[model samples]
Target: MSSPVALIATAKLRREDIDAFTTWQGRHEAAAATFSGFLSSDLIPPGKDGHDEWTLILNFQTADQLTIWQHSAARASLIAEALPFFIGGNTGQAMAGDTAHDTSVTGVTGMIFSRIKPGMEGRYREWAVRIQAAQTKYPGYRGIYLQPPATSGKDATWTTFVRYDTRAHLEAWMTAPERATLLEEAEEFVDNMELVRLATAFPGWVPVNATTGQGPPDWKTALLVLLGLFPIVMLELRFLNPTFSAWNMNASLATFIANALSVAVTSFVTMRLFVRWFDWWLFPNAHRPADTTLKGLILLFMLFIGEIGALWWLLP
Candidate 1:
């Protein structure tokens, strides 16, 4: 199923009211924890500009599911609790899945952001570091990274990376009582922040895997293959061209070089196009299935074979 992307933004009401802000935020977090379809919320800290802004990025199964939370009584209560802490206000946007939205084919990636009180920034980081380390022992946990907010700002922010297997899986994690309580605890450190979620836009197909463990494509291998093709191509083009000039170079080493280059280029292009397409249609954590990868590679390789065969038949 395709997941809808949510972009949520929030900021503080006052730079000096950290204690009151944290208290109100804790209750607000509690309120959000009660909602359904609440996959994961990211609390992004204010960046270099000292904006005290926080972003919550969420993934949901569909717009309908998101609407449930949008219209929920709990959400109303949460907002009311957060009203006094609201500094700069908040805004949200939800994009419906088009042909390009697919998380099942391309992995989706997410980052969590939060703004800790100025003097409490180190404590907030300590909690995140320890909690993330403990969470890594769980089944769906992949890996994580951290980023600190600007020190020059009135509000300090921190960011962390989190991964899950699917939108459903992420929702399940959020729905847990333990997880909700952790959110409440985390809220105690922040004056105000937002949780913003984003997914790449692709058409029609969803990603199959969303785990960070799958790793990115081996660009080194692809680059080596391209580098290796150069010498072969030059040898055939320059040294063997004279000897096979009568046969249009089809019988010469250049033909092999050309075939190899074609294969390598085609594979590289196909992989990139596929990744780009998947990024658009699916979440960053999503992945195309193993069979899907095989099928794509086969199709690419066949195109290469056909090109070579056609050249042999027509030119020679």
Candidate 2:
């Protein structure tokens, strides 16, 4: 069976042309939907404080279908219509599989776009390897994925996705003196660079507001995670441990199984239920009274106590 595919396209636009570009983008999406095997499309606009680049992701069932859409006359015409609004011509990269819809991401991600100077691709790649190595030495470093220019010839743009466990950890890597030195050295090979930070406590598990591109704050997410996780851990210790011991499973393997089950349960069942029940608390409106936060905290505290009390009775 063919793997799913996604095309991620980005365009830079001037401030004044945003409205026109948005209207044109709607037409573009309409045109794309007419193609065969098209699954879905998502438009991520620029954040309030970042680069003015808008990203559009298109998912299709197969690469052949995506190729057909890309090479079609309808897409060409739409691109031509939208070209006037672009500051720099649009660029795109394709990833195989359903990466576009991946929600298992657990940290902050930085999307870096760099334009390498002519004939410096080799040097830039070498630099990338070194910088990647340097970042791995830092605390909370997750991983990085790099993509070369989507098109052949004069287009030298490269896209990179770097992840760290939290915004503070990511910022530590980004603002470190080592990174600063690397950037200084890169000046010889790189013409321009842009970094966009995507902040989310639990990306796929927690919904991000379309306009704001943000999820609930980290503290709230942590508290919710604890609330959901505590019961699971307690129940595992009470019921699952004896079964594992009976099966002669070692501590390491038993612990691994327990963690895996906990993560799966939290991700699929508990998190969803909690998010739904606490939607108002998770995303209170801007004008919501301050006590709204306190009220939610109090409610959570009560739930914690209730869980502890119930488990105490059930276990012992």
Candidate 3:
């Protein structure tokens, strides 16, 4: 896959036309979702100070995917349809820049849009680097994508992409004591903030229909996770623990190491593969749902049988 790209557009509106513009924006977003490579999209409403106007942010899996969407006739049709509503003169150009997306970035992302004080761009960027470095030291930290204020927008704005393995870790860093100090240090620069979480954790990797909604039901997710994690846990327990035990580590530390190793295996290997196998279950829309419930029930029963068999084999 190509490197992911952060594409943002800002539009200024006649205050009275906000409602009409928003309706058009929704249709536009729906159209964009049909295309391949689209990841997630968000809209930031204009602020009280009239700094940002309105912003539409989009994430694509690759630059090529973005280009395909950008040059598509469908996109052109929508823009043409909505041109009349841009009475306040669109400021979208200012909200986008040549922001680079890192291909290696996988997992959930936190898309943060921040507007800095007019003269604070340099200081804001410096502060951003420091905070990202600090966050890197924390667990689940993946990487970041920063887009500078566009030359055509109404204000000095920046978009930061924060990738994390889980929401818990993301929240931890956001609420950490260090973050308080970091925010204080940047108080002179940041003017406003808008943050949108990118994806539901990993079970979301189930490539279902293109949607922004939460992944399948909690029970479904729990079942799928259990399916993916169980064998990984069993295999590691059977083979890997003895290797760690040779180091004569304490029971608590040894268990921790085993857990960490197994979780890593689950996240990167098993879960990735299992999602494909369960794609029909995850994305019922892609296939007929006539017997989905039956399939799921049968699979659960099979898992029940397998568990008893595996236990019999390993117990001795």
Instruction: Report model 1's TM-score to 2 decimal places.
Output: 0.31
The lDDT-based order of candidates, best leading, equals 2, 3, 1
Clashes of each: 56, 0, 3
The pairs that clash in candidate 3 are 10-92, 94-152, 94-153
Q: Which tens-of-lDDT digit does each residue in 230-292 have in candidate 1? A: 444544555556666866765647667667665665456544555455342222322345466
Off by over 4 Å in 2: 1-198
In Å, residue 113's CA in model 3 sits off its true spot by 19
lDDT of 2 by residue, 97-161 (tens): 76553335457887777888888876886676567657766777654555556454555577777
**Candidate 1 lDDT for residue 296:** 48
The TM-score obtained by model 3 is 0.45
Candidate 1 has an lDDT of 0.48
Per-residue CA lDDT of model 3 for 199-291, tens digit only, reads 455443433222222355556656767876777777777777787788877889888988888778777876777666776676464237688
List the lowest-lDDT window of 10 residues for candidate 1. Answer: 200-209
Candidate achieving higher TM-score, 1 or 2: 2
Looking at model 3, report the run of 10 residues with the lowest lDDT sum.
204-213
lDDT of each: 0.48, 0.75, 0.64
